[model samples]
Target: MSERIITPRNRGFLFLDAHPAGCTRLVNDMWRSVAARPAEVLGEDAPVALVIGSSSGYGLAATVAGLARAGIRGVGVSFEKAPTERRTGTAGWYRTAATAELAEQAGREMHFLNGDAFSDAMKDQVADLIEERFGRLDHLIYSVAAPRRTDPETGVTYASALKPIGATARTQTLVFDEDGKPDVREVSTEPADEDEIAQTVAVMGGTDWERWVSHLAGRGLLAQGFSTAALSYIGSPLTADIYRQGTIGAAKAHLERTARTLDARLGELCGGRAVTSVNGAAVTQSSTAIPGIALYTGLLRGVLGGDMVSPVDQLSELWDQLTGVRPLETDEEGRVRLDTWELTDKVQDAVAERWQAATTETITDLADLDWFRGSVRQLYGFSVPGVDYSASVETDVAWPASR
Candidate 1:
């Protein structure tokens, strides 16, 4: 198989290709980055951890990075489907395999489970697997982002559709043109109904987190003083209507509440704890699909000079919080406020200013473009190495196990 060079263009979607070696290189780089800057506080060595939504995006990368940095050997359970030859496993799946392979090479124990995380059978399987293998869990990370969920009580499967809040919401988006500036265009979307909002909350929100925590707690599988965390995001006000205030916002609110409840329950169990980390807006397979986030991220990237932190960096911070080395800011509700730092008041103010000033005549600059490009590149196996981009590439590269 010949390697190919993958680059991002203005098609407005994530360009994906399977590059196992590139994925492995990312894992290696992440390990080096974390080891060079070890956290001041550290958790017990080789503590067990379980990551749901463990196959892609921030969740997958975070799981790999956290395990490598903390020197913890644990089981990873994700609902990632197997990858096709023409395309990479979802970013998370590739990263999971890459991380596990690297960890094994480093003399660390690791395991991967592929299945639906929201299923009761899968949950029981995970608990049983832990009991049969490691006996206890020290950390739990919930990274799943399903758009719809089945109602356990009603036995109805509800899927969510994304749209604006009111009659219609108009927003500016950065559309790349051949000319350097981002073309600002007004975009509008319809509003979702009350049932849709509720369903969205049920699916994408924190109920799964609570279920996992409760399941582990009830089964006595959670270790004493363990730490559990879930990822959340609060973008600028531009996206608040659809994201922070709309269906997703409602879901996040539920998740935030779930975090607090889990924290108290876990505290009672092992003196353990539960936390939620609000992450910055980075290009993920998921985040890109959101209406105005791409423009906001692109604009923020332009403003910030494209030096945004990668999933590995965020994961390091998450690990630091989990191990009690660094203190995480929490609201009255008790969720770790990482997003506030990622999208600082200064940054938000600047973005808002740019958004207001944005017009078709004036687009974003190269600095912002760089940020967007960097994130987009990282989503696929680009920017990481051992990939020979000069040659024609095969999109359908099969995994070793499947092959």
Candidate 2:
């Protein structure tokens, strides 16, 4: 192993390296949190699940909870860069490795496939693995967050653009100085042109999800009571122009519609079900890139405080919904609403007030910049407690094989 002292390196919001020890710590925390919940008796037959994009954010949290809390055997697929002798791997790589190690200690059957989830070859490999080992798929979680996707059949690539639909969106957002100090600044995002909007939808929309389910069905891999969930987010008016009513929103709209169509098809296919889970805002790698999300989430953290539901908490509840431990709660459109806490009138009113009052001078007072900063660090395996940043670490960490 090539060992070296590693610290956080970043270019604006993009992180350059990840610490394996810190990634292990983050996964351990997630495991402990799930273990703290009252234990469930998953009898002799436990569900087999497949989680696409199961390396970070909601997907990673769901994998942790599903194995540690819900007692499920599963497969997780993600695309991450493996570490070289001179470079550290992506955070998701370390996180996936750590999660696999912990799952092994817990005596769980967790397999991992590291490749593009949108590719036909990847889907075929997963389907074959399920057929040979697991027999059937009980649950499917689609949580992919990608910038671009190449259509396997058409040989064309689509790149997602994060911009408004009809008009330019202007807002006071968060920016970091060279020293990594946070400050409020105004940023304007131009609207996406027609091609960009279509491309965004192509990359981020539900067509890929539909393809996955369809492929699994063709393979006769869906179980009697199979269920699928695609993670989605709907921010409030503060960031709606760049979020809920934006290019990403158009993709999300298609995702939700696909869920409806899938729900109807699955209802007939095996008494199965499908729904889009609208998760609450939290510190995620994807969220930090959006135009106004940093300011909005910072204000949200300030206002919600103890009431905030983490990705782990929300995904644990999602497991509960899937396993029949509790009733599945959904809105009129049949979408699961996990953002209720963030959207409550009491919370939004306070957040909106702060959003309007926020400026560079008052940003510290108006938002939880500290929490946001720390959370973003935790995403890339930095700022984690008990990890010695000064110590030499193995840059070439091996990803554990499927068990």
Candidate 3:
């Protein structure tokens, strides 16, 4: 494989020139990052799992890693519009194929479903397929990060905005030039209305999650001890204005709330077993799109080791909880707090103080920048080991027949 050039352009999206061998190497590297530890023993009969949005980003990678770690065979459902004039395959789609192929090589059974996850038709198709193939599903993972969604109740599609709360909010961001200097650039954002917030919540929030659970339960397809989880993030105050305090934040709050309701419902079905995981912040494609968060993540990269727990690690932890190997502890509100250790007062206080000083000071060390860049690269399939960059690659790779 020839060396592939990868660049981050306009937030979390990556512009890549890839080779098949490089892509394979990338997937292998991700698997090695969280290979099972001796302390963790998967059940002899691994449960079948389904991962919606299991084509790219944390969701796709986590789906692969979770299945592998749990020693489970499962299917992944992703929406990648291709062969429709666009003629493009989503990064997740290609990664899903790579992951499935890798799993098969290890003598595991995996399947992929490609379509719009929010569609009722797609959900029905998945439920039917699961009943036909596996007869029952033990776990479901919802890791979608779509910016726009059509409202089922209102019959209108709404797109999420990345601007700030007011008519004009200016914030400083890092602009990486050819020389890789963090040039300070000011960004201004526009405000949104109440309708937009509600609509965005309806689509991007936890409604679809609830519907999936209800549909499966209604059909009597869910197995006992079934576990489902959706990932959420709460960043620093600098990002809170645009993230946790903005329209997206409102949607996440809805997700957090909906988890409780879903937990109660699933508990009745599965004997008091269901969970929601609030994961720690790393450079994910979705996280990068949030205003001012890239800078914050970059700073965190400097403080934490460059190898801040990978999505593979997060997935392994999720599987541990799902398989009853590690019991999940909840907060007072009955939400799974995975990052409670990272979100402690001391950690937040230290990061906040560093962020305040970094804004004014000249912190241009490679060590500091590696904190962010490393995390970002790991989010995508880059900088992983065993990839042969000496050969040529293609960005347009296809998943298996099912995907």
Q: Which one wins on lDDT?
A: 2
lDDT of 2 at 33: 80
Candidate 2's displacement at residue 77, Å, is 0.2
Candidate 2 per-residue lDDT, tens place, 1-403, comes to 6888888889877888888888989999888887434665554377899999999999998899888878888799999999986678999999999999988887778899999999999999999999988899999999999999999899899999999989999988898998977888888899999999999999999999999999999999999989999999998989999988999999999999999999999999999999999999988999999988999999998988877998989998998899888888889998999888889898999999999999888889988888888899999888999989999988788887866
- Evaluated against the true structure, the overall lDDT of model 3 is 0.68
Instruction: Summarize candidate 3's per-residue lDDT along 8-61 as a digit string, tens digits.
Output: 332323533223444466676777666674543344366788888887666866
TM-score of each: 0.86, 0.98, 0.87
Give lDDT for model 1: 0.71
- For candidate 3, the 10 contiguous residues with the lowest summed lDDT are 1-10
Q: lDDT per residue, candidate 1, 1-403, as tens digits?
A: 5344544343555554545556666666767776523432233356678878776777876776766666666677776545564445565566667777776766556777777788777788889878887899989888887766665546778787676555576676665555434566877878888877877877888877888888877898888898888888877887887688777787888988888888888788789788788887777878878877877887777667535676777787787778666775577777776565556788878877877776766554422665565556666666655666565544444332310
Alpha-carbon runs more than 4 Å astray in model 3? 1-13, 16-20, 37-44, 81-88, 152-155, 163-170, 359-361, 374-390, 394-396
Report residue 268 deviation for candidate 1 (angstroms): 2.2
Residue 253, candidate 2: Cα error in Å is 0.3
Q: State the C-alpha lDDT per candidate.
A: 0.71, 0.90, 0.68
After TM-score superposition, what is the CA distance of residue 166 in candidate 2 from its true location, in Å?
0.9
